[model samples]
Target: MKPRLHSQLDVNGEAFAANREQLLAQLATVEAVGRHQQTSAETKREKYAQRGMLLPRERLSLLLDPGSPFVEIGALAGYKMYDDKDGSGAGGGCIAGIGFIEGVACMVRVDNYAIKGGTISPAGMEKALRLQTIALENKLPFVTLAQSGGANLLYANEIFAPGGRGFANQARMSAAGIPQITVVHGSATAGGAYQPALSDYVVLIKNQATMYLAGPPLLKAATGEIATDEALGGSDIHASAGTGDYVADDDAQGIAMARAIVSSLNWSSLLADIKQDIPAPSYSPEELVGVIPANTKTPFDAREVIARLVDKSEFLEFKAGFDNQTLCGHGQLYGEPVGIITNNGPITAQGANKAAQFIQLCEQSGTPLLFLHNTTGFMVGTHAEQSGIIKHGAKMIQAVANATVPKISIVMGGSYGAGNYAMCGRGFDPRFIFAWPNSRTAVMGGAQAGKVLRIVTEAKMGAASDAAMLEKLESDTAAFVDDASTALACTARLWDDGIIDPRHTRDLLGLLFHLCKHADKVTTRTNQFGVARL
Candidate 1:
C-alpha cells in the first residue's frame, strides 16, 4: 500500500475557510443545546446539597477512573418532546456513556435525579435500550448509578410494555457473564425497584437510598397497612434482608464501594495489551471540518476523508476502476485492519455490484467494515433502471445485513432513501452508528419530496389545479422536511447513537475498534438462567 497524496483539499483556500465557518456554527448550536440541558440539571444542585447528596454528574465523575475519557451517548435525546416545552429536557433525564472504571471499560448509566426526579420518558427508554444493546454487543460490564422516581406517569402508557425489556436485558447480561452493578442513591419505587433487585451486585446508601415495590403512601392506600419508608425497604433493612450487597453512609462512599467492586472483578486482566507507537494520520484531523462542503449538493472525493482517517494516510484501494462512485478499500486505524465503504455520489448499478463483492471479500477475510454515508440514493433514471439497479441494490443490502463482522457507520452528509439501508443506517443495527453535525437522513431530499408531492397532487386535480396553491404546498413541504431531517432532530428521536464532531471521528473509530476486538478475543460463561438473589 502506498501513501495517498493530499492535494485535493486546499486548506488555505477561501472555500475551505467558508466551509469551516459554517460547520463550526452548526457545531456551536449543538453544543449550546447540550449546555442548556446541563444547566437545567444543575439548577437543583443547592437542593441536593442541602439533603447531603452529590449531584448526578458529580457521582459519575467520582465513579469513573481519574483522567479517563467518557464517550457520551444520546446527549440530546427527547429535545422539546413531551413536557419539555423548552429544549432543556434533552438527554432523556439521564447521563450515559462508556468509560473506564478501575481501569476496566464499562457502560455507565446515571439517572439525572435533579431533573424531574430522573423520570424516564419514552425517548429515555429508547436510549436505555440502545445503550444496553451496545453493552451486550461490546461485552462490557454494566454500571448504573440508580436514583429515580420511576416512569413519568405522563407517558406511562407508551413506556409500560417495552419497559420490561430493560429488566430482561439485565437478566440476559448477567446470565451471559457480563457483570451488572448498581448503586442506589435515592428513591427506586414501583418499576424502578426491579433495576437494583435484578443487578448482580447492589450498593445502597444508608439513609438516602430507598428501593421498594410500594412506597409508604402506596402501601397504605393499597392494603390499609401503614408502614414507614425505612421499615418497608430502606438501605439498612435491605442490607439485613440480603437484598443489598453493600451499604454505604453517603453518595461518595457508595461510589467508592462500587469502584472497589469493579476492581475486585479483575476485568482488565482479560484484555489484550494495548498496542504502542501507532502512526498518526499525515493530515490534520482539523481539516475534516473543511473537507465537507458548505453546500450540500457539492461533490467531493470520499478518498479525501479516507486520507485523513487511515494511519499515515495509507490505503489499499480495491477495484479502483470498477465503480468510482462507491469506494472500497483496506486501511489501518490504530493498527487494526479495517475495510471501508464510502459513497462519493449516488449508488449506480455498477457501484452496488462493486460494493456487494467488496463486502463478501471482507467477510471472507474476517475484517471489520466501516461505512461513511453520503449518498443521495441509488441512481434513478431510465438508464439506471435498464441497468438492473433494483436487482443489484438488493444484493448490496443483503451483503450488508448478513456480514458477521463489526459494522460501524458515520453519516457524514446526505443519507437519503434506500441509500441509508445499503450504507448500514440505524435500522440494520450497526455495532455503533454516529452522525456529523451537518449530516441529514431522510427518505429523500426536501426539494425532491416537495416536487414529488406537487406532481401527484396536480395529476389528481387535473385542470382544476390552482397554480398559487400548488406552489405554496411545494414550498411548505420542502421547509418541513428539511427542518425535520436535521442532525439535531434525528438525534432527538434516537436516530443515530449520537451526533459527533467531525474532528473526533478518527479517535472515536479507534476506540470502537479496540472494544470490538477485545469482545471477540474474550470468552464469557453462559448459563440457562441469570443470577438471582436467594
Candidate 2:
C-alpha cells in the first residue's frame, strides 16, 4: 500500500480566499435561477390552485416516499430560453430526478403545468430524452406526473423529429421489462398522447386528465365531428374503454394509485443490498469552493478535487510517473471501487496514451469510471503534432467510447476543444454528467477564438487591416464567445445534466455511483415486444 497523498494547500491564503469569493458569486447566480424556476408568481399560484390541480412539485412530493432525497436533474434547463424573459421557466417545463416511491427508487418526471402549460421546448425535449436514457440504462422504474400541453409550437420543427425517439425509448424500455407508470394529471394531446399510451401502467385523473390524438377543435376541422373532451378522450373513457389501467377521482388519488402500483411491483427486491456503512472522505468538501482558480486561465491541480471526493482522501495513482497531465488512478468512492481520470493540464501524447491504457484496465476489472474535466485541451503545437498527440488523443477517445463501465463526468473548469470530448462532455454519452457553476466549456478560450478570427480576417483581406475596426471585431467576438462558454449557457443547451454547488460534488457522485453499481448488478426479465394497447 502507498502512503496517502498529503495536501500542501494553504486554505487561508489570499489565493484561496479570492477563489472562494469568485465561486460564491457564480453559485449565487445558479441559486437565483433555480429559485425563480421553483417559485411562481402569486397570481399564477392562485390561478393554478383554482384549477383543482396540485402543482407539479406537490404531486412529486406526495408520490415520493417520506424523507427520501430527490436528485433533481437539469432544474434550470431552459434558463432564459425562447420567450422565457423572466428566467422563471428554468426547468424547461419539467422536473425530473431519481426519487423513492413506496421505497422503490424510480425515475420521476413531472410536467410543470404552472409554466406555459408545460410546453416542451427544445431543451425540455432534450431533458426528457436524457431522463428516459437514464432510466433505461439504470433499469429503474419510470414514473411521470404528466400534465403537458404538448410541444411548444414555435419550436415544433426541432422537437418533432427527436421527440419521436422519446416514444421509441419508452416502448423499448417496456420490452426490456422496465415498468413505466404515467399519471396523467392534465392534457396529453397531439403527439403527447403516446407518453401514457406507451407506459406499462397508466393512471388517469378523472375530469382533469385527457389524452387524445387531436382535441375537439382539430377533430371538428379534420372530420366535421363535434365532440366534448370527455367523449373523445377522458379518464372515464380510458378506464372504461381499457386505454387506462387505473382511474382516480383527483390529483392526490392519482398519485396514490401510482405509489401503490410501484409498491406492488416488488421493484426494490431486485437490487442487491448496498453497503451503507461507508466511511466519509477525510477532507472537507467545503474546500472545493476554493480549489479552482479564480481566473479561468489560471491552472490548479485536479488532485485537490480527488483528495476531497474519494474515501479517506486515498487514491492509488496509476502510471504515476508516466504522464503528469492526464491523471488516472483507482480509488474508492463511498466504499465502492472506481477508476478516476482527471486533468492536471492539457493532455499531451503521453497523457492521452496513459488515459487510454487506464480506461482499458478499469473496463477489464468492471470498475466504474469518473472523469473530472479541468483542461485547456489536448496540447497543440509543432512539437505536440510531431509527438502524435492527435492519434494518442483519438485512442483515449475510442477507449472512453467503448468502455463498458459506467462513465460519469464533472466539468470543474475549462473544458475546451477536444478536451471536452476526451472528458466525456455530452457526446460521449456518460451515464451522467454535471458541471460546476464556474465551469466553462467551448471549443477554445474566448481570447484565443477572437485572436484566431482576427488573424484569419486580416489574412483574407490582405492589406485591409483597419486597426480600429479590427479591434472592435476582436472584442465583440470575444464577448460573444465568453458569454456562450458560461456554465449557464451550456446547461441551458443541455451540454451537461445540470450545475451543482461545488461542495455537493462528493455526495452527488456517491449517490450516482450507487445507482450505477445497482444497475450493473440487477437483471430484468425481457420479452420479444413491448406491452401494447391491443
Candidate 3:
C-alpha cells in the first residue's frame, strides 16, 4: 500500500530537471574524487613496487596545491625493469608537471623515491627535459624536488636510460634561459649532482641531502680518497665552492627557499612598485651625519647605520653572509620604497659581486636606487684575483649603469677608487648624485694613499731619519681624502646634482624619482610579466 502511494516521486517531474543539473555537479565531483583516489593509490604502487617509492604525482601533492590537477610529461618512461617481474616505475621514467605552488601556475619534478631508490630513469630524464622545454616555451620557472638513488644501475647495458638522456640534459636544460631550481630534499649523488650545478640556484637540506658527482666508494676505489659523504657534496661544500647558491633544512625549507627566490626575481617588484606608495625616509638629509659615526677607521655595522638613517628600518637583505664588505636591501621612507647599497670595512671582490647582484635586483624591480658610498678600493690581492673579483666588480658597475630607475647617491662615508664608480659614482647614470659633508672622495683611502706616499717620502728622504719623514707622510695623507668633498669634486666639476642631510634621504629619493628620466624594461624576457612565488 505504501509503495503504491509514492509513485517514484513523479509528482515533481519538472523540478527533476533543475535537480538533475545540481546533482550532476556533485556526481562529477564524486567521480573525479573516486578516480583521483584510485589513480593516486595505483601511482604509489607504481612508484614503489618492491622498494615502495613515492611517484612524482604523489610528491607533487605533498609539494604543491592540494588536489591540484597536473599535466605530466614522460609519464610512460621505463627501462629493463619493465621486463622484470615488477615492470618500470610510474610516469614510466619522467616526472614533469604543471601544478599550483600555493595557487599559482608552477612547474615541478619530483624524483620517485619508491622506484629504484628514486634514481634518474630514462623516462625521468626525458620528462625533465620535456618539462624544461615547456617551461622555457611558456616562460615559467621550473622547480625540481630531486631525491634519487644515483642512477638506474640495472640499465647499465642500455645505451641510454629507457626514458631518454642519461644525465647530460640536466645541464642543457639549466642553460636554456628558464629559471630552474634544484631542491635536494634527500640524496642526489653521482649523475644526480649535474642538475643542481646547471640550475640558476639550488636549495639543499641539512643532513638529509647529499649532492656529489661521486660517492665515497668510487672515490676510495679510484683515487684512494676516503671522504665523508657530507664532505663530498654537502650544502657547505656547494655554497662555498659556488656550486650551490642557497641552503635549506627540509622539504618545507627547500620550498620556502624557492619561494624567496621567486620573490627576488620579477614578480614582487611589480607588486611593490605598482602600488602608489613605497617606503620613504622620514628624516632630513642634514641629519645624516648624526646617524653615521664621525671616525672613518672605527668599525661599525653598516646595517645599524642603515637602520638609524633610513625612514623605516624595514629592508629585505639578500645573501647577507656572502658579501660582508658591501650590502644592498630595500626599505621605505615617507611611505616610498627605495633600493639601498652600502660599502663597508674593505671592499673585496666577493663584496663587489654581491653588490652587483643587489644592483641588478633593484634595477630589474623598478625600485629607485640609492648609494651609501664607502670603500678603500676594489679588493686588490691574490684572493681578489682568484674569486673572479674583476668580473663581479664589473657586474656591479654594469648593473648600476644599466639601471633606469631614479638613483640618489648618498656619500654616507668614504668614496674611493672605482669604488666611487661602483657606488653609482659619476658614470653609473644615476638620475642625480649627492654627497654628505663628511664624505671623502678618493681613488683610495688615506691609509691606502699613505702606503704609496711612504715610498715617495722614503725615496725623497733617503739620507734623512725615517721617523721624521714618516710623520710628514702620515700628516699629508690623513687630510687628502677629507679635502676631496662634494663641493670640491661634485660642484667643482658639476658631477653632482646637490648635497643633502642624512635625514632628508627619503625626500631626495622621492624627488629624484619625481625628476629623473625612465624607460621600459630592456630585459631578454618577452611578454612574460615575471615569475612570482607560490
294-376, model 2: which lDDT tens digit per residue? Answer: 98778888888988898888889998899898999988888789999999999999999999999999999999999999999
Candidate lDDT values, in order: 0.91, 0.89, 0.58
| lDDT measured at residue 64 in model 3 versus the true structure, 0 to 100 | 69
lDDT-best of 1 and 2: 1
True lDDT of residue 96, candidate 1 = 98
lDDT of 3 at 428: 64
Q: Largest TM-score belongs to which candidate?
A: 1
Q: Which lDDT value does model 2 have at 475?
A: 92
Residue-wise C-alpha lDDT for candidate 1, range 203-292, written one tens digit per residue: 999998998999999999999999988888899889998999999999999999999999987675322445678898889887999998
**Which order, best to worst by TM-score?**
1, 2, 3
Winner on TM-score between 1 and 2 is: 1
TM accuracy, model 3: 0.41
Q: Is candidate 2 or candidate 3 better by TM-score?
A: 2
Show the colliding residue pairs in model 1.
none
RMSD to the hidden true structure, all candidates: 1.2, 1.5, 27.8
Off by over 4 Å in 2: 269-272
Off by over 4 Å in 1: 269-272
